[model samples]
Target chain A: MDYFFFIDLIQSTVDGLLFGTTYALIGIGFTLIFGVMRKLNLAYGAAALAGTYIGLVVFLMFDAHPALVFLASALGSGLIGLVVYLCCFRFTPSNYPMASLLASVGMLLFIDEVVIHASHGLPYPYPSVFRDAIIELGDVWVRGDLLFVFFMCVVAMAALFWLLYRTPLGLATRAVSQQPRAAQLCGIDVTRVNMMTFGIAGVLGGIAGAMTAAAVGVLSPVIAMGLTVKGLIVVVIGGLGSIPGAIIGGLLVGAAENIFLLLRGVTERDIYVMLLLFIFLTLRPGGLFGSAQTRD
Target chain B: MLEIADIKTSYGKIAALKGVSLDIHDGGLTCLLGPNGAGKTTLIWTIAGILKAQAGSMKIDSEEILGLKPHQIVSKGIVTVPENRLVFPDMSVRDNLIAGAFSRRKEKGGIEGDLEDVLTRFPRLRERSEQMAGTLSGGEQQMLAVGRALMARPKILLMDEPSTGLAPIIVEEIFEIIGGLRDEGRTIFLVEQNAHMALKYADRFYLLEQGRVTFSGEPGAVDHDEVIQRAYLGARKAS
Candidate 1:
């Protein structure tokens, strides 16, 4: 019994870590937009869901390849991101952060309603690239789809790092993030940079959405709100604007969630996750890697 | 040459610059001396397109440039070294300098050459190139701010209180740099509370009081002590 319990713990941890990559990808999308604009985009998950829904339509109608679906999802979501910036963030008075937050929440509900109406509030089958493929490591089993998600997440992060460090647009984005007024004096166009940031976040979200749907082998409107809540929890636990923090936060949340599921049950899992968030908030409000003083 | 005629700027209901007029001539340093709240920074921001002027005409060599954006103004070769040395603290000194050339990002070769030249001009910054700007001392930060503006290749440099909050020796070093820029035939519009250092380098000087230009003349034409006193105190007391 003791040996079996240890094996179960290890297996759960491995599974959680792999699944956490999806959460990290989603968390990164949130962090990137927040880093640049210093505003929460509550509609981020819904936007991703919208892209996933589009990908589902393409797959259903044309019998598209998995790669084509992911591509379509990214492009569709990227366009929606720009639209969200224009509608929810762009024209709002910059000083009024609450207005933008509320606007994004409104967008979130609108997108959820749209998706529900389009699909008749029903879940759709999402094709998995690595369907039924699992690797056996002694007593533990690893899903090939989850491993693929992990690999894709690493590739995405590496690409993100390269874009942020080696490109002019990335430099401008960092500059604007650090000191917006100074960036303006440096002749960096703040509005253009902000719009581009939103688009990038959207692309990331779409990929994450597609990956999550494939992992679950289903896509539904309910996933939109669930992902948003999970994404926010990851952001808060990691640190508001720290990229690395979001990744770690996602993994930590994932592992803790699985452990709680084993100790308690499915119904009581989120209770422990919320408890963990509260502990982090009370003891280390800046999160695992954030400075105490954040941009107000 | 830059011309400012009847430029009026306000902060909400409070007007900071009321019908302010001045001429910033080519290839010479024109200094504006004023007490606190005399609209010196306001004028600089307005000229740099960071602030809007309710009523005025700002012309650069006969082209109207009053309503242009800040980056547009920068591309026009008007760069500003803002007050309080606002550097991007989280970025390295080198990155800060590179960001200064954002307006001319397409000119790769020119940017590289300019970056080398700026580093050479401030060796201290070169030594701390990889260090974050926030970690630098106040004096070093001031140097970084000036170097940042220089990277923009400005035809007209608008400097606002470059000497504020620095050691006396550092202030002298900063003035020397400013004086060096003036000698290099750069058109400079300087707003300063340090009238003494400003007078040492200014070809012409203006005294601004309560949002208006109250006095304008060559530095040599005025008594240095009286002008310094008037700069610290309002013109009403000096009169």
Candidate 2:
């Protein structure tokens, strides 16, 4: 019995290691938005889930493959991200950064309500390619779909890294992020760069949302807030606006939650995750990769 | 040539420039000397279109540009090297120079040629091309700022206090570069507190105090004592 429990723990750990990539993707979207605009986009999690639903509708209408559905979802979410910026961020008085934050929170609720109404508060079986296929490594088994998700995560991260560090567009983004006024003086349109950042982050969120729904094999409107809390935790623990920090933080949170769930139960599992966030906030508020908390 | 008429700029309730007016020639060095809070910086920002003038007209070559955006000003051959060397600190020196030529991004060959010209003029920047702008010393950053502005290939350069907070040797070096720019047939509108150094190079001088122009004259005929007195200390004492 004890040996069986140990195996269960190891399996759950492996499962979390794969699932952590989804969390990292979600957190990266949040971090990129924060990095460029210096504002928290609270609606990102809800937007991601909404994107997944849009993908489902596209699949139903066209009988498209899962890959195409995923693509559609990402593109749709990118559009939504731009819309959110236009409605919530663009026209808000520049003097009040808090206004954008509060507005985004309102957007989060607005998106959530829309999703709830459209779905009638129901949970549906989501598409999961290669769901039953498994890999056996001695005494352990790995889900094939999870392995695919991990592979996708690596590809997306690499593409993002190239886009951010290697291209002139990335340079423009960095310039806008650091000194918007100086960038404007340099003849770079600051507003355009901001819009680009939001679009990129939105696509990333859509990917994360679709992948998460596939991994869980079900989609529920209720998980929007939970995913949001998880993403916020990842961003805080990873250090705000730090890409590598988000990745590491997501993995850490996923592993800790899995371990906690194994040791305790479902009711107490979230307590440990919250405790970890509190500990990081108290001990190292700058996060593992952040230098300091300077609100832009 | 740049011309301003009745330019009134304010911050909230307090007016920084109260109907201030000035003219800059096409190929001469013009210096604006003023005490702190006398709105010299405000004047520079207003001309650069960073601050909007409430009731005024600014013309560059007969084109009205009072309400135009900053980038538009740059496009129309007016560029400003701001105070405190406001270069992108994290960007490489080369990048800082490249950004200066951003308005001319469409003119690839011209930008490349101007870059080479700027590099030849400021060899120190060439040496530190890959270094971050923030990592450079105060004097180097100031030089980078000037070089960056030249990348725009401006017809008239508006420089605000290029010599602030620098050693005497560095100040001399900066002034020499400013003199070089003037000799290159570029119009320069310089704002400075160091009247002694400026009078040697400036063709025309304007002294501002309390958001108004107190004095404007040629270098040789101006009363130096009165100018210095107003510069270091505020208010001309009920005269």
Best by DockQ: 1
TM-score for each candidate, following the candidate numbering? 0.97, 0.93
Whole-model Cα lDDT of every candidate shown, in order = 0.90, 0.87
| Best TM-score among the predictions, by candidate number | 1
Give the per-residue lDDT of model 1 (tens digit) for A1-296. Answer: 69999999998889888888778888988998998888999999999899888899999999999889888888788888898999999999988999999999999999999999999999999877786888999999998998887887778888889999999999999988888888989999899999999999898888888888888889887899878988988988899888999999989888888888988999999999999989988998888888734441
Every model: Cα RMSD to truth = 1.5, 2.5
User: Model 2: residues >4 Å from true position, as ranges?
Assistant: A1-13, A137-140, A293-296
DockQ of candidate model 2: 0.51
Docking verdict class for candidate 2? medium
lDDT (Cα, 0-100) at B239 in candidate 1: 32
Tens digit of per-residue lDDT, candidate 2, span B1-239: 89988999999999999999999999989999988899999998888877889999999888888988877888888888888878878789888888888788777488778888888999999999999998999999999999989998888898999999999999999999999989988899999988888888999999888899988999889777777777767666686
What's the distance in Å from true for residue B118, model 1? 1.0
Model 1 stretches astray by more than 4 angstroms: A292-296, B237-239
